[model samples]
Target: MTTTVRIATPDEVPILNAIRTSVRENHMTLEQMADYGITPEVIANLLRTTGRAFIANVDGVDAGISIADSAEGNIFAMFVLPDYEGLGLGRLLLAHAEAFLHATGVASAWLEAGAGPGIRAHGFYAHLGWQSDGLMPDGQLRFVKSRAALTQIVAGG
Candidate 1:
């Protein structure tokens, strides 16, 4: 029940890959992931760029992961193991991503989610105050949220 989130180091790619591939929705197989340039080296290189990766643990067990890119102002990725779904780890990880963007002086951040009907991510982003701007050419739903407004909400405005 003890939940914690931390900056993920380069050596933890397996943990990242584990949480990522565990998702039944929007999953990429090992080959597919590498095909998309999502290799361990890329993950490490990304962390050295205008982005960061995070790992969330429940009772000391890795359960989720997220990556936020301040340069792109994007929540590049987020995933949680199915068994960890109901524990609110996704929310915690997302907040870390947003905070990373805000702290880097980004005014807003955006992320892509599966646009298909009945996809929980669409509603999840909306429920978190991310406005659905439009559907992207990639057929993913684009969701945006301004850090200023988010700060206000956190401040009890």
Candidate 2:
């Protein structure tokens, strides 16, 4: 199967949200996700504004998504369909988001990982060399990565 990652358009917000909702490990139901501000309208606005969203398609099917808020030096979101996991799509999307943030002159990027059985992101971020920076105001664990460190990691030393 072939995979392609590309900038996501505003029109793809629904697909992005769908992928996010399908992740049982997120520990959030559709209603809860909306309460947490994961609505399509919010995502669409992000796509239209300072955020950069990328979609990963496998065999021409929407499979994953990654989003970054360059202005805030934060990874706003990243999700892959359960069926598409273990295919390196998440890593690819993350790399693209980090590159985009670095290109925007961001020195560091951060993201909040929820605490629960449904939250499987901490290990993934940790595997990519991100460090935990304590809890965010919202109580989620904050993960951070620096551009310089990422550069060194990519350079293999």
Candidate 3:
């Protein structure tokens, strides 16, 4: 499927929130995700943030979402829909975030993935050559990749 990435507008908050809920539910314990805690307030806050949000569409249908907060030149919150998994859409979203971060003068990007069930997410990152620096607060694993490094990986791929 052809993929397109673009900056998400405020009107796309609901779609983005739905994508976030879907991704969070996939990684959260069933008991915790039972209620599906996404709210418009959360979406509003995210839209108002300093960071950027990206939406990915496959064949013109919304397929994924990614957000990156600029912190010490480190990008964050790279996520994709489960249905879109294994199709390299995650890598596309991540590359978009990295380019955005790098354009904003970030030399590196960092992401956190669940250590247990979320371990699958690590494979996606590692496959792209991101280096794992191990655990972080909340027991998630941390991955660090330089913008130049990711550029090479994506280019080579």
Candidate 4:
């Protein structure tokens, strides 16, 4: 029942994509990913540059993933295998990604989610302290977390 999160290796596009495509929510296929310029080479180059990906393993098996765009201060993606759901791997991976962004000096970070509140990720992000930031021009929901906001809230501002 032990879970671990680690920075994904440079060539983990296949593993990362497998976990991504396996999700029923926020579902995306290989072709759809490619259509969005998320090809394997692009992912690899991102890993080598402005993006960082984290893989979560449960009891020694790869079960989930999180990716962040450092330059954009965005949580680009997070996904857990259906078989690995409910074990809190997604939360752990997300915390790790957020920690990475914080370490890199981002005051705020954001991630897009499905349009409806009924989507599991909507609740997940909300539960993790991400504030709803309304919809993107393309209609996706944007959620953000800000260290500065947290500081202001803590100061009763």
Candidate 5:
């Protein structure tokens, strides 16, 4: 399927929220996502401040969404619909996020993925060549990749 990715606008909160809900329910454990947050207000605020949100449409349908925060070049949120997994969409969105970070003049990107997701995200990061330093206070594995590496990845594609 042909997938199109674009920057998100404020009006896209509901869709973004829905995407967050999907991840929270299917991928993130309640303990990992934390019930205290994930509210509409919180998600909205994140989309507004941290950085940019990008939505991916596969064959004209919303398939996944990701948020890249300029602060520390974090991959704040990344979720793909269950059906859309393994279609290379996740990698596409990640590359988009990395490129966005690189454009912002960051030398590297960092991300934390909770262990409860059942997706072995730490391994996923490793597959992408992201170096894992250790776990965070939230019990999430931390991964970092240099901007040069990500740029070469983006250019190679």
Candidate 6:
């Protein structure tokens, strides 16, 4: 499935919001998302400010999305549609985000994932060699990865 990852424009905020809202696992309702500051307006502002939002298209369809905060070295968000899961789109999006961070002179990156039921991101991050740094104040699991390590992994060490 020819997957392409590209930086997103402000106009694609709605599409990015749709991909984020469509997550079946670690699901968050619109109200819950708003509580966590995940509204479309917030996302649009993020895209405008950082220009780090990326969309992954599979066979000409939006399959996943990722957003990185280069200044903070944070993988702020990443989500893949349920139907697109297990096809490696999520990993692809993550790599794209990490690469962006690296290019921006970030040596390390971190992200928070849900710790509640139906959350499977811990395993995914671990499998990708991210180090666990325990839970955040918000009760989300924190994972960190170094750009040098990722480069080694990608180059087959």
| CA lDDT, every model vs. true structure | 0.83, 0.81, 0.69, 0.84, 0.74, 0.81
Most accurate candidate by lDDT: 4
- Residue 84 displacement in candidate 2 (angstroms): 1.1
In candidate 3, where is summed lDDT lowest over 10 consecutive residues? 148-157
Q: Candidate 1, 6: how far from true, in Å?
A: 1.0
**What tens-digit string does per-residue lDDT give for candidate 1 at 67-102?**
988888899999999888978988888877887777
**TM-score against native, each model:** 0.91, 0.87, 0.76, 0.91, 0.81, 0.88
Quick one: best TM-score, which candidate?
A: 1
Instruction: Give a tens-digit lDDT track for model 3, residues 75-130.
Output: 44556777887777787788777776666666777887776764677887788778
lDDT of 5 by residue, 1-157 (tens): 6878888877787776666667632465434445746555665676678677788889988888877887758888788887787787778888888887887778788987765546456667789888988878867778888888774334221
Model 5 alpha-carbon miss at residue 132, Å: 0.9
> Considering summed lDDT, which 10 consecutive residues are worst modelled in model 6?
148-157
Name the candidate, 2 or 3, with the larger lDDT value.
2
What's the lDDT for candidate 5? 0.74
Supply the global lDDT for candidate 6.
0.81
Candidate 1 regions exceeding 4 Å error are 151-157
Per-residue lDDT for 80-123 in model 2, tens only? 88889999998988888888777777888898888654467888
| lDDT per residue (tens digit) for residues 102-141 in model 6 | 7777778899998775578989989988999988998899
